[model samples]
Target: MSSFRLTLERRQQVSTLRSTTTYILGLLLGLGFGLLVLLSAGAPAATLLDDLVIQVFFSAMGLAQTLTLAVPLILVGLAATSAMRLRFWNVGIEGQLWLGAIGATLVALSDFGSESLRLPTMLLASAIAGAAWIAVPLILKLRAGVNELVVTLLLSNVAYLLLQHLLFGAWKDPVNSFPVSPRFDENEQLASLGFGNLHSGIYVALGITLLMTILVQKSRTGFYVDVIGRNRTTALATGIPVTATITLMILLSGALAGLAGGLIVIGVEHRLTQTIGINTTFSGIVIAFIARFNPLAVLPTAIVLAGIYNAGGTLKVFYGIPDAIVVLIQGMVLLTLLMVQFFSSYRVSLLRQSAQQPGQPST
Candidate 1:
């Protein structure tokens, strides 16, 4: 009996260790792929790795840019994380982001010229617009039982087209002769955080992350969301308001995504452009997945992704490699991490040998 108990304990220990090993393996695999990319580019792999290490850790300017890029990614990733936690797949974060920017642009152009009120007003309007955009697919899913994945993706394309039309047709700035919206007023823009180009968006993103962490870990609403996501049928049977819970989660996610877009306009780009939405939405999805849909984890993950983006610029200037190389590395890393998650959750074990001595106890 003691031997049997020891065997059982050993199995449990192995299982725990397996989970830890899986994530370490995933990180190493991602690094290997990055190294392979550098080798293929004809750069010394060790040197390239050293350079990236320096840029990410040692250079103050590089660190600032990393935080700057992480700002929007944090919001976008949180949006994805929130929807995902409630078992809602909101693939239209990109469209919602565009809607937010468009909404903010409208506010900037309107007659509300008070310096004190402009930023807050635009943020509010953008949040509403983003939630409204997401509501289309949410209603379709809840009312008609439509698959949200298709609806959300299709709406993203529609949103992009709408942005194009506005930029080229009505919102285009006549003085600049560019296919972009007018620059936001000084009062409406987000202020810089310090002497660097980093904006207040970094603080907003961090603040949102903190708030979400608290909500997910402490709030009653979060408890309901967790329950609904883990087992919707069970939750419904237990008197939980599954539909309302899902809707609220999706709405909150959309609002956060809108805030991300608003930050891009008011903080980084300072104007709405058609190119902003091209790949940023997709990047958000990647960041969210890479972080395992954890709201708190999104910060470090976003910062790492931003480092790659910043490093890609350096790679381009110093070497002849294309920027797409960085994207490829990101894709590989995400794929590997997903595989690691899968393996950690499941295992294959060989059947133990029967202990029957000879043919005595075959039964």
Candidate 2:
């Protein structure tokens, strides 16, 4: 019994370590492939690698840019993590983000004179809007027994159409002749850090990450969510409010996704546009998957992804590499990580002598 318990504990420890180790291996493989591509392009692979390392680790400005890019990624990653934890697939984070941006745009356009109320109102509206956008799919799943995956994906396209409609019709800047919403009020803009283009959104993202970590690790609601995720029928049998738990989890995920959209507008874009939501939903999925759906792990994963993004611009300018190279690297990294997960979670072993003999008798 003692040895059996020790073996169990050791297995658990190995499983936990497997996730971190696999992620590191995946990143290394991605870097290796990137270098191969650089060599094939006739770029100085050594110089490019050195520059990337220096920019990612040694340059203060580079670090700031990375964090700035990571702010939205962190928020959206958390959103994905939340829904995944509840076994709820809220894949419409892209649409939720757009709705959040729309909400923020509405607030920015309104005549809210009080400077104090401006930021808070925008943030609140974004959260509400995000939740409302997700509620559509949630209701469809709960009430009509729809497959959330299809509903969420379709909604993302719908969001794109909505954005285009607003830009070309109602919210078009008549003077500028551009398909973009009106610029945000100056007061509505997120405060910038002294560093390179970093904004208050970084702080907000960090705060949310910490808060979510605590909520998931320490709260009763979090416990119930975990239980429901692992075994919904068991949770219902135990008198846990499984439906309410699912609803809250979906709403929380949507709110986080919305916060990411709000950050994009208030901190980066300062206006809504047709292209604002592009690729963000997919990026969030990558971040969440890379982190293995752990909210706390999402932080470092977001930073790494952000570094990749920043490096892409530098590569484009210096090495004449296309911007698509960065996307390709991200795809490779995700694929490798998934493969590692498969190996870690399963094992194949040879059959015992007696079993093998019986199975091979006919042969």
lDDT of 2 at 97: 93
Residue-level lDDT of model 2, residues 236-320, one tens digit each, is 9999998898899898889888878888998998988777766777788888888778789999999988887887778788878
Model 2 clashing residue pairs (backbone):
none
Tens-digit lDDT string for candidate 1 (1-363): 112211211223347677668877887798688778777986666668655768865688888887888788888889989988877788899999999999898888774657788898888888898899999989998999999899989999999999999999888988888898888777878888784579987888889899998888789878898898899889999998888888898999899988888888889888899877556666777888877677899999888888888878777787766878887888788788888867667554544454556657567
- Cα RMSD of all models vs. native, in order, equals 5.0, 5.4
Q: Give the true-structure RMSD of model 2.
A: 5.4
Q: Which runs in model 2 stand beyond 4 Å of their true positions?
A: 1-14, 17-20, 37-43, 350-363
Error of 1 at 94 (Å): 1.3
lDDT (C-alpha) at residue 9 in model 1: 19
Worst 10 residues of 2 by lDDT: 1-10
Q: Estimate each model's TM-score.
A: 0.89, 0.88
